[model samples]
Target: MGVVNVTPDSFSDGGEWFEPDAAVRHGLDVLAAGADLVDVGGESTRPGAERPSVEEELRRVVPVVRALAAEGAVVSVDTMRAEVARAAVEAGAAIVNDVSGGLADESMVPWVAHAGLAFVAMHWRGHSTSMQSRAVYDDVVADVCRELAERRDALLAAGIRQDLLVLDPGLGFAKTAEHNWALLAALPVLHGLGHPLLLGASRKTFLGRLGRHPGEPLRPPAERDVETTATSVLAAMAGLWCVRVHDVASTVRAIAVVEAAMEHAPEEGPA
Candidate 1:
């Protein structure tokens, strides 16, 4: 998956593709670069970012989704609102990548179920503006896994098909740098939940922090592509079903390398 943020305030690449034409072209570029799907998000969920009204988000995303789908691209609408998801699906989105995991909108699960689209349920504690305050966790990995399990069970009870769902342990939503690293390291634990995993660590602030030197400013979001690619490769090796990234080309190449490496590895004999 490749990210196309059609908002003016996303933490990374905001305003760069805010225009519909630019966003559509970027989506095409992502597909050309080997992404299986393009995730178009009109609202910026960066920490402390303000929410956009439904009308504005619809205006920004619907056209882009329509254009991309018209071009035969698999598109995912990255939204928290059921109304936006409904509109995007009608406009040509085949997937609903709800960062809130149906927590933000009560109608989201039912709507997704009725629409029969792929659903990405991200682990979210709260909306971006207040998420930071909710980041406290005794054991970040275990807590996240438990909470995400609860969400999965709830969605199942609400009529969402298990096979149509994907889980994302949201990297930066309300997590610290340590927490993000812990989650990445615990991919196997998350995978044990019996659902396909979607890892979205592309150009996030935690990657920037990892690249920072003492007494130096953190690397910018754009500069974290290298680390993001590394994460993509590792995620692929860990059997993640997909990785959401801003720079699709690099990640595609990285996953290719991982695949080739695994393909050539010696087979194990029975222990």
Candidate 2:
């Protein structure tokens, strides 16, 4: 999966693709670079961000989704609104990637079920403005898995097909850097939930903070591709279903190598 933020305030590459033409071009670029899906989001979900008006979100996202899907790129609307998702589907989106996991909008789950679109249900605690305060957890991995399972059950109960649902741990949504790392290490445990997993650790703040000296500035989001690629490689090795990334080509190449290496590994256990 590749990320295409159509808003002016996403944590990374926001205004860079705010224009429909530019976003469409970017969508094509990522697809050519080997992304199986292009995720187009209008609203910024960065911590402390405010919600965009539904009208503004629809205006921002529908055209890009329409253009990208027309060009034959598989498109996922990264929205938490049923209205936007409905319009994007009408415009040609095949999947709805909701960060709120049907919790943000009351109408989201039923609408998704009615449309029969594939849904990426991320584990979310609250909206961006206050979500960070909700990061509390007894055990990050177990809590995330338990919450995700609750979401999965709710989504299924709302009429979404079990197979069409994909789980995302909401990597940086309400998580501290340590929490994100812990979840990364527990990818297999997340997979134990009986659903395919989507990992979106690409260029996130946690990756940006890695290895930085005390009092030094964190790595810029655009410069975190190296860490993003490494994490994507690890996630792939851990049986992740997909990785939402800003830099798709490099991760694609790395995963290809991983696949090739796995193909030729000896049958005996390493130990």
Candidate 3:
């Protein structure tokens, strides 16, 4: 999956594709570069970000989704609102990538179920503005897995098709650097929840913090593509369902190398 943030305040590439035409063009560019899906989000969910009005979000997302889907791109609306999800689906979105995991909006799960679209339900604690304060976990990996399981049960109980649902661990949403690292190290535990996993570690702050010197600023989000690509290869090797990324071409190429190498490896054991 490739990210297309059609907002003026996303953590990365804000305002670069805020215009519908530009967003559609970028979506096409990502698809041509080997993205299996284009995730279009209007609201900026960066930490401490404010929510946009529903009307503004709908105006920003629907047209871009329509244009991209018309051009044969598999589109996912990265939204927390049922209203926006409904409009985007009407405009040709095939999936609803809700960061809140249908927890933020009461109407989201039902709407998604009725639409019969694929849903990526990410584990979220709260809205972006105050979510960091809620990042208290006893054991980061175990806690995240348990919480994600709860979300899975909730979504299934809400009438969403079990096969059509995907779970995301919500890497940077309400997690600390320690929490993020711990979760990444336990991908198999998350996968054991009996659902396909979606990872959105692309260009996030946690990855930027690795190897940084004391008092120095972390790597910038745009420059973290190298790190993101590494994680993309890791996700592919871990058997993840998808990896949401900002730079799709590099990740695609790297994953191709991993695939080719794995193809030649011994199936049962090392030689």
Candidate 4:
């Protein structure tokens, strides 16, 4: 998966592709760089961001989604609104990558099932506006697993096929840096939810923080790709089903190597 931010306020690469044309171009470039899917998001879920109105979100993503789908790219709408998800899927998006895990919108699950689109149910609490307050977790791993399991049940009840589902641990949605690292280490546990896992740790704040000194200014999002790729490699080796990334070419290379090494490893089964 390749990350394509159509919104102007995402924590990373926000304004870089804010323009529709630029976003489309970036989509094409990512596909050429070996991204199997292009995730187009209109909302900036950076902590404390305001939610864009439905109209604005639609305007930001629908055209881009349409163009990419027309170009034969597998597009995923990174939205939490049923209206936007429905519109984007109608516009050619094949997947709904809702960061909210069907919590943000009442109609998202049923709509996704109705359209038979692949749905990524990312763990989320409140919307970005107040999600910071909801970040507290006594046990981050258990809490995330519990929440994701709840969402999975909702999707199943809403008529979505279990096989059409994917789970994301909501890397930076409301998680602290430590929480994010914990999730990274425990990613395999998320796969135990019985859904394919989608890891979206690319260029996140945690990676940037890792690159900074204790008292120095934090590294910027754009500068965290190398560290982010390192995490992605680890995630792949840990059995994550797919990784959402911005620098798709490098991630593809990294994943290819990981897969090759895993393939050639001596069998570890019963002798």
Candidate 5:
């Protein structure tokens, strides 16, 4: 998966693709770079970011989704609103990548079930503006797993098909740098949930913080691609089903290397 943020305030690469034409082109480029799908998000969910109205989000993403789908590219609409999901699906999105896990909108789960599109249920504590305050966790990994499991069960009860659901630990949503690292290290625990995992740690603030020194500025988002690619390689090795990233080409190459390594690994003999 590749990220295409068509908003002016996404923590990374926000206004760079805010224009429909630019966003569409970037989606195409991502697909060309070997991404299986492009995730187009109109709203910026960066910590402390304000929400955009439904009309504005629709205006931002619908056209880009339409254009990409018209070009035969698989597309996912990254939105919390059922209305926006509905419009994007009608416009050509094949998946709904909701960061909120259906918590933000009452109509989301039912709509997704009716549409029968792939739905990504990320572990989210609250909306971006207030989520940072909710980051406290006794055991970040265990707590995140519990919350994600609850969301999965709820969605199942809401009529969403078992196979249509994907789980994301939501690397940065309401998580501290330490929490994000813990989640990544606990990928096997998360995989034990019996659902395909979608890891989206691309260019996140945590990666930037990893390169920072005490009292020094964190590395910018673009500079974190190296670390993001490392995460991709680890995720692939851990059997994650997909990784959402901005620098798709490099990640694609990294995953290829992982695949090749696995393919040629020595087989166990009478172990």
Candidate 6:
């Protein structure tokens, strides 16, 4: 996966692709660079970021979603609003990657079910503005699993097919740095829920804080590809179905190595 943020306030590459034309170009470039899917987000979920209104989100995403879908690339509209998601799918987006996991908007789940779209339901506590203050958890892994299970149940009740859903362990949302690492390390726990997992730790703050360099405070988002790939490999090892990443080529390369290793594992058959 490759990320294309059309919002000017995204944490990593905020203003880079804020314009529709630039976002489309970036999406095409990422696809050319080997991204199996392009996740186009109109709202920035960055910590402390201000949320954009539904109208603004729609204006930013619809064109890009339509264009990318027309170009034959798998397009996922990264949104939390049911109205926006409804318009996006009509415009051609094939998937909904909602960071709020149906908590932000009441109609999101019904829209997802009605459209029969692939859904990426993320673990979230609140909007970016107040999420940091709500990052309290006794056992991070258990909390995340419970929250995701609740969302999954809601989706099922809303008439969503089980196979159309994917669960994302919202890396930085309502998760302290340690909490993020705990979730990453305990990915098998989430997988045991029997749902396909989508890991979205690319260029996130936790990746930047990993084992600091000798003379560096911490690598910025632009410089965290190697660290991101390290976690990508770990995610692959955990048997994750897909990884949502900004650095597409490197993550793909890392998964390739992991996949090859798994394919060649020595084993006894029917012994």
How do the predictions measure up, each by TM-score?
Answer: 0.98, 0.97, 0.97, 0.97, 0.98, 0.95
Model 4: per-residue Cα lDDT at residue 166: 92
Clash tally for model 1: 0
Pick by TM-score: 5 or 6, better one: 5
The count of residue-pair clashes in candidate 3 stands at 0
Model 1 error, position 220 (Å)? 1.2
lDDT of each: 0.93, 0.93, 0.92, 0.90, 0.93, 0.89
Specify the poorest-scoring 10-residue window by lDDT in model 4: 204-213
Runs in model 3 lying further than 4 Å from the true structure: 269-271
Clashing pairs in 4: none
Could you give me the TM-score of model 2 versus the true structure? Answer: 0.97
User: Model 6: per-residue lDDT, tens digit, 158-204?
Assistant: 88889988999888998889999999889889986778999998889
Compose the digit string of candidate 3's lDDT tens values, residues 191-259: 789999999999999888878998889998899999999888888889899999999999999999989
- lDDT by residue (162-252, candidate 4, tens digit) is 8899999988888888999999888778777998999989898888887568988888888888988898898888888889998998898
Query: Candidate 1: deviation at residue 166, Å?
Result: 0.2
User: How do the residues 12-111 of candidate 2 rate in per-residue lDDT, one tens digit apiece?
Assistant: 8758999889989999999999999999999999999999999999999999999999999899999999999999999999999999999989999998
Q: Positional deviation of 124 in candidate 1, in angstroms? A: 0.6
lDDT of 1 at 186: 85
Off by over 4 Å in 6: 213-216, 268-271
Mark the 10 consecutive residues where model 6 has the least summed lDDT. Answer: 210-219
Q: Write the per-residue lDDT of candidate 1 for residues 1-271, one digit (tens) a residue.
A: 9999999987888589999999999999999999999999999999999999999999999999999999999999999999999999999999999999999999999988877778999999999989999999999998999999999999989888989999999999899989999998988888878999999999988888874687788888898999999999889989999999999999988898999999999999899
Alpha-carbon deviation at 106 in model 6, angstroms = 0.7
> Between candidates 1 and 4, which one is better according to TM-score?
1
